[model samples]
Target: MASRGLKFVNIQEHSDARGNMRIVEVDGGLPFVPVRSFIISDVPTGKTRAGHAVSCDELLIVAQGSCLITARTAAGLEEHRLTPATGAVHLGPGTWLMLSEFEPGTILVTYASERYAETRFFEDYVEMDR
Candidate 1:
């Protein structure tokens, strides 16, 4: 499994007698400087989200619980299970992403390189292929 434009980044966790914390910054584990950020949570079971591709890059982090992420690119399809310890997945432009099989109370945080724009979204996979 080569993930083409997608990259898995390992997050560094700092632990002490108090607790643990993971920091994300540009040029660190985060590949891009995010201009937008969003959170997805409280999803009902047996449901999916994000069946589209964007022109700008994105990074997804599983803040709590777990979920399955499926992405399609020019190379092929790639699947990944996202968990707190699993770090984050960096999605390049034009990569189709679908998130599903989320555990109860799963919280996913996403960072985007660009602001939201309807014109930058490709809802159909066929359109992305072109």
Candidate 2:
């Protein structure tokens, strides 16, 4: 929830006889403009991906399939199930994330406020709780 500064963005979908569409923009609800973007797809069953804490915020969107994202921070830990309907989950700085229990053909898209920089990321979860 917003209490932890974590937000679940609800995307408005427009559907008709033709197809369905959803529009997301910087000014819509995102706190910051994304400078870098990436996608995770075809994750094997029982596999997991862990990410370190970074200086910038992140927006994770489950474009396809489904997965559970657990994020830990100084405040505590929060888990979110992202789907196409739920849209995206926003994590602020100093948050460590772990992705697991991915369904077949699951596709996760991530957006970052800052450009990719290895030096800006830390894998030490303990340090992030400081």
Candidate 3:
């Protein structure tokens, strides 16, 4: 399944008569302070995004709808179905991640420990596995 470097974190949710909210913080919820963040949405059906690995850590949240995430690990390939109810997944270095099967209007929110740097990214899964 998933590499030990990848972990799932259930973000704390606060709900009320108004709505629901989740809290993400350094040393409290998130293990590290995110210097960069991004959102993935509007992914077309049958399209898949793969071959991305970074040197730092990553935290992914299913903000809306659902999607499937697959990561390569030493043990084998591990797959996870992510929905707003499942919370987030924290992936450390050396893990290859692929995202697909996104429902319409699905939103994926990502937080990274470091800012963007071409040198910090490895497009090859083999390079990341090392």
Candidate 4:
């Protein structure tokens, strides 16, 4: 399901005795070429992160463990539970995101379409000029 510009993508996974592996590529599971990437982990239970919006597109993948992601936009509010098997979620520019309910050892990897810039982030959705 999709809300506003947010999309839930199911990436193809290959499994074997070695373990499981999933690949993301431009125009594939990932919609754009990423200029930056980051990993988030060690979040305490009941804590939240990212209560704001950005001017760049991003893809969030729960590489290990799980977490709950809530996104808000002009359209409405949507929630998703992300696990390794759940693939990834795409967040477009100006979409507000709040992540919480993190299980221990949860590792979230994010790919961004733009370079990191503090001015590109907005705490208030209404402040976005878009």
Candidate 4 wrongly placed segments (more than 4 Å): 1-4, 126-130
lDDT of 1 by residue, 1-130 (tens): 2223788888888999998888888877578889999999999999999988757788899989999998887677788899999998888888888899999999999999898873276675553221
**What TM-score fits each model?**
0.87, 0.84, 0.87, 0.87
Ranking by TM-score: 1, 4, 3, 2
Error of 3 at 120 (Å): 3.0
TM-score of 4: 0.87
lDDT by residue for model 3 over 1-130, one digit each (tens)? 2244778897989999999998888878787889999998999998987567646788999989999998876556778999999989998876778898999999999998877773265675563332
Q: 1-130 in candidate 4: lDDT tens per residue?
A: 2225688877778899999888887877578889899999999878988878757788999999999988776677778899998888988887888899999999999999888873275675643232
Order the numbered candidates by lDDT, best leading.
1, 4, 3, 2
Q: How many residue pairs clash in each candidate at the backbone level?
A: 0, 0, 0, 0
For residues 1-130, write the lDDT of model 2, one tens digit per residue: 1223467776667899998787668988877899999999988889888666656778888888899887776567778777887888888877777789898889888888888773276675553232
In terms of lDDT, the poorest run of 10 residues in model 2 is 121-130
Clash pairs for candidate 3: none
Candidate 3 whole-model C-alpha lDDT, 0 to 1 = 0.81
On the 0 to 100 scale, the lDDT of residue 68 in model 4 is 90
Residue 20 of model 1 has an lDDT of 82
